[model samples]
Structure formats: C-alpha cells, structure tokens
Target: EYPDATATDPTIVPFGPQEGESLSNCSTKFLERIRDWCVNKDALPQTVDVIKLLLVERKKAECRVPTHPPKDESTGDVPRAIVEAQQDEIQFPDEESK
Candidate 1:
C-alpha cells in the first residue's frame, strides 16, 4: 500500500511546478520522483526497468550531442556476464499470481 496522507498534510508535497512549466522540466522532475520511489524495498521490476531504460536513453542522447567529444574507438563492448550481473542487482524477482 502507498503512504497515507491527507490534503492538509504538509510533508506530502508535490514534486514539481503546478502550472505553466515546460514539458522538459516536468519530465525531468517526474523522472527524479520515480527514481526516488524505485529505491524503496518493495519497488517492482517494472519500476526498475523504467529507470534503466531512462538511463540508457539519456546516455544515447548525450553521445549524440553535436558539441560533445567522441568516445574512444579502443573501448569495447561490456561482457555479457557483467551486464547480466548489473541487471540482477537492480531487478526484482518474478511476481506471484494474486
């Protein structure tokens, strides 16, 4: 279950601007909130997957920036086992049927 809070609760704050904000700013704030939520012990696999996808997309975008320096050609692909291990660290176990 989610945290219990009433409308008058001061600590139950919104993550970002309420109105007239740019889409990019809103998106960034939303991602930050999701990342924080994903740190909880009960986070679902789907939540972790969303964070991973966001990270990979961000890296790809950074690489595509015109003014950014290029990556060195000498670096090679990450080993499959290492990649799997990293995923395991973040991933949740399969959910049981309700």
Candidate 2:
C-alpha cells in the first residue's frame, strides 16, 4: 500500500497497546516500531487487561448450561444478583513478564 493509503487506514490508530488482541498476531518488528512510536508510555490506567476480561466473558458465554435449583435439597433459592455479587475476578502479571 502507498504511504497516503497507509495514513488513511483505520487500523493504524494510536492506541495499539490498549488491548492484547491488537498485538496478538503482530510481527516482532511491527511490535518494536509501535513501541517506538508511543507518545506516553507511562500514562496507562491501573485496571485489568481488556483482552483478559473479554476472554473470561467469552468463556462464560460458552457455558450456556442453565442453572437450576436442586429438586430435593433446597428450602429457598438465592437471588442471581446476590450470587453474582459474591463472585469476582482479577489478573496480575508475574515478576518476569514486566
């Protein structure tokens, strides 16, 4: 593609490192060049990776098995919102990866 065409390409945005999927299959040289072009390497937010969240959500999405209360044991049913509130997820990179 020509230089003018590349400049107009929507995929060539500035937020390349904003998500893991954006760099998932990228070449090593392309990765390095993107790193070099970073305007603010130190201003990222303190939050979970978008890719990890998407993966967890995707996994949950695939688990389409509808849950039901046991026929013989339950005296009362817990609300879905309360059960969901008790569950949480987090991810942290190991020491060597940073």
Residue 12 C-alpha lDDT in model 2:
52
> What Cα-based lDDT does every candidate model obtain?
0.48, 0.36
Please provide TM-scores, in order, for all candidate models, with all chains considered together: 0.31, 0.19
Candidate 2: tens digits of C-alpha lDDT, residues 1-98: 44665468744533322222212222233445444444335423422353454446445533532344223246475543323322321222245643
Candidate 2 colliding pairs: none
TM-score of 2: 0.19
Candidate 1: TM-score? 0.31
Tens digits of lDDT, candidate 1, 51-96: 6766675556444433423333578654333333333233222346
Q: Once model 1 is optimally superposed onto the true structure by TM-score, how far is the C-alpha of residue 72 displaced, in angstroms?
A: 52
Runs in model 1 deviating more than 4 A are 1-17, 42-44, 48-98
